[model samples]
Target: MPEAALPEPVRKRGRYRRRLRSRIIVSFVLLGFCLTALFAFATNWARQRVENQLVEDVMNRNLDASWQSYARSGGADVMAPVQQMRAFLIRPDMPDRLNSLRRDFPEWERLQDGIHNISGEDADGKPFSYKVGVRKTPDAWFFIAYDMSQALRGEQQLKRALFFSVIVFSLLSLVLGWWSASRVMRPVSDLAARLRAYRGGNAHPEPLAPRFPDDEVGQLAEALDDYSSRLTEVVQRDREFNADVSHELRTPLAVIRGATELLLARPGLDEKVLQRLQRIQRAEQQCTDLIGSLLLLSRNERGQGSSNVARVAEQLLESHRAQLGGKPLELELEGERDLVVDAPEAALSVALGNLIGNAVKYSQEGRVLVRVGAGMVEVIDTGPGLSEKDAASLFQRGYRGTHAGYSQGGGIGLSIVSRLCTLYGWQVSIRPGDERGVIATLTFTPG
Candidate 1:
């Protein structure tokens, strides 16, 4: 289907539903979330590194302090006191005890002076984790163990808290993102509202740049002001041009009509000359109707004039009947009566005339029917059946059909009809008829 067939309200609703505000909000939210998540990750990593360094430093200090205490006591007592730490003394001469140490940690007695995590159990048969250190003294060796289970458990708790913090802050980012988007979009929305409210022709639009901040939105407002000024000027010029042309053309057309009437009024005129004069009068009348319709279109206004749809169809059929040349064709008007429309007679005449004219032109030997009833008028033509290309682009301006070979038309007749239908809130569609013809429908709101 053509876009012109879609109701205006539906198109407007579709455009509104796809507003940029929602997209802007979503973009802001995603950006905030990504930055916050990255910051949280970096913070957690740095904290973990500092915590590990502090734990190692504390272990080394405890080892050094206990070693000094044992040396001061002259190695008399092998046990050195330390909080949350256990010290062991091993001699090279004690075979059974050293073998027991070897069984527990074969490499403990030969270890160097650095911290190492070891798995073990306390005397109470509870599993424990410890950071152990080994030192060589003058008389014997010392093994110092620092219980690390508490510290490891505290680290786990901190990890849980950090993960929870990431979640909380991410949620906060979402709220902040929504607020920022609203603030950013408010100016744009106001500008759009102002533009939509301004009507042309007599009312001037207010200057928008002064009301907005000095940013991208302000620049857009300034651009819109300039465009509005230029567009208004152009529209004014077009209105003046149309008025002048319509006036100039009408004067000559009126003279021709008057002269043709006088020639017809003369007594004892030739039948051939009378026929030519009558044709000239009809042409003059048609030119006047065309002028009125064009002026109305140029002004983009709809006027209310009650006209019977069937009566107009009948008159149009009569006009086409006279111009059929010698073709064996039949013109008929059918369907219900009193189907009035709320539009000017020239509007209806131009709209219906083009359709009937096209039917009479292409059709050679079959009946052309105009069916009028209710809120619709259907023009059925047994012309060369419409091709797919023609049916799709028929009403487009300057688009001639494949069967329009050598025809005396500029191909804007249907385009004008379509424009009139649009201006009057009416709908028009042209399609290939069932079996062997074409159908053009003009549907109007019921009067």
Candidate 2:
């Protein structure tokens, strides 16, 4: 079965979805986010380490000073005081408040040395944070508490700043990334636009190297210029060669056509001789039509002329019928009259001629019908039906069908037809007929 064609806009959308701009933007966003997040995490960790060290140092110094004052005062109950700190001696007869803390938090009493963080409520039932240093003498233990509420608030403020900075930097990175991508792609976009605007014919395009800086884009421009120059030379050589070959071939075909017409005009010719002359005439005509079609293809341009498709089909059928050597096959044309198409008569004749000729060549004793309708010409042949694989690749160059056993062809007939249809903005499709044989359809676009 033939595949359905997608709409042009949908096809373009699929192609655009994978464009480089989106990929570049996504890469930039991920990079910026990862870097900023790492920075924020490291900032928080460093701040925590420094703040804890300073708080522990302050608690240790104040605890040592209070202990020194108690010793100098000869173990006085009331010792020298310190700012934002309080010292306590834990004994069996300690106050209920201090006893309650040691009972509730066993870890605090278990501390042999060093500083610790403690969380609790004050007498007014207000939440508070503090750090403590525990010192154990021979007969007594000293616990010093330093308030940490201010330091905690400061840490919270720093954390808030770092969080906002991450958000702000990420957004800034996104903006900068978008701007950078636009700048990076500008030259490439310009190059593409210029390429799209180019209309190729006999003239070569302007050099693009001089228009760009000596960057990667500039190197690309230079490469494109060099390639275009070489390709132009190749196309020019091909055109000259085709023109020379077509000219040289025409002289011999003209001579053969003239000689055959002269011999056919003679009266009372033998039946065998007449048939041979007619066949020679048909062969010359086919050659001439083929040459014309090939030259048009080489030029890659549509010929400016209108021809009746039915008339062309009828002529092709008649020509094929002349070459059938006593074959029992019947050729018929069943279509609307005067179905004109906007193309040279020779091109149409060559295209339709190849189809009708193939049908006649393959069938031994069956009928071949050419039907012309609204915008289509279908050649229905009663030959063996084509396989799915053969139908898929039938139009490819040098690809013969599975049933093309010992056929005298190079497999270029359908290839030529397909090329001609493309040049003339037409479509050709081959599919198996309802039960047997193949139906080849040439659908022409209305101008």
Candidate 3:
């Protein structure tokens, strides 16, 4: 069968089952990554803020101490306060000191009374960074430079470490997500497997709740158990009812058959009366065949036999002819006469009978042809042409077609035919005929 012929619900179900587990795993991995990345960003920001505050405080305090020492010494002291600190002093009367300051720190003359950051290469062509603190009095000006090269190197090292930590933690998150996904999905997978095992119709299936703990999965299992119990009860009751009905119906049909046979045996029976009696016999036989086929369907079992397709078609056409009366319809049988099918006579009769009956019932005039070929049969009718709505839903139980006005049927005949085809591994299709009416084809060897 072509994929385009499959029902919409079947295709949607296939897509959903394939993606569910993978979607769960992908969700977990994404959540882990987002949380880890957020933490890394916060940690880096806080470290940079605290380190800048501490460096500024130390530079301010040292500048104040150096100016106080020079004031106490009566403007004569010129020594540095710390190993990483350099002090420079200039007075208005000292021309030589001003000239020396200009040659060494040219940009420092315009400094205000606060710390400022500066970086550049020295005379040795090596890169250096420092914080310069300025203090000015009416008598003298003092400048303190604090070297920050060591602190800059330490900050670079800390950044490198944090980068590696981020990589390591992200990888850890990936592994944790994978493990957690497996653990979470195990119970769901097990439940699905158990349900699949019970699909072949177990007489008494094992309880699922007992195998799982008292959680969400356990609740689901318990609910399934309740539903299964109710379904099993319903199916059993239906089977019993069908068996009882078939038995009761056969008794009356058998009596009718016996009465008709005895009447036909009489020597002086009138022609008209004999024809009526034979019609009664044929009706009884048709009812018997229908009951047997329905029983097999209810039991979901297949019957075994080999039947000649041409012979069955001819018999069906003859039966329909007797019922036609004054109707202007022609019934014909054509194609291969020796084609055989591997199915019971009653099953074949019920299936083909429904097709031929529908053709005769719907067509007002022209020919109803039954063509038998190798492994297949086609019932062509000059009935009112099929509509799209009828073609789509004709085989559904209780669905009457748009043109089925006043027809004496509950619409289950075609439904039964569809089930029989499924049980026997056969294929059936209906379409509009070439010029007019409908054509229904049934293939035994569909593969």
> Which pairs of residues collide in model 3?
none
Question: What RMSD, rounded to one decimal, does every model reach?
Answer: 4.7, 3.7, 4.7
Cα error of candidate 1 at position 356, Å: 1.6
- TM-score ranking of the models: 2, 1, 3
Which structure among the candidates has the greatest TM-score? 2
Model 3 local distance difference test score: 0.84
TM-score of each: 0.79, 0.85, 0.78
Alpha carbon RMSD to native, model 3: 4.7
Task: Mark the 10 consecutive residues where model 1 has the least summed lDDT.
Answer: 1-10
At residue 40, give the lDDT of candidate 2: 86
> Candidate 2, residues 146-206: lDDT per residue as tens digits?
8888888888898899889888888887888788889888999999888878889436789
Which candidate achieves the best lDDT against the true structure? 3
**So what's the TM-score on candidate 3?**
0.78
lDDT comparing candidate 2 with the true structure? 0.83
* lDDT leaderboard ranking: 3, 2, 1
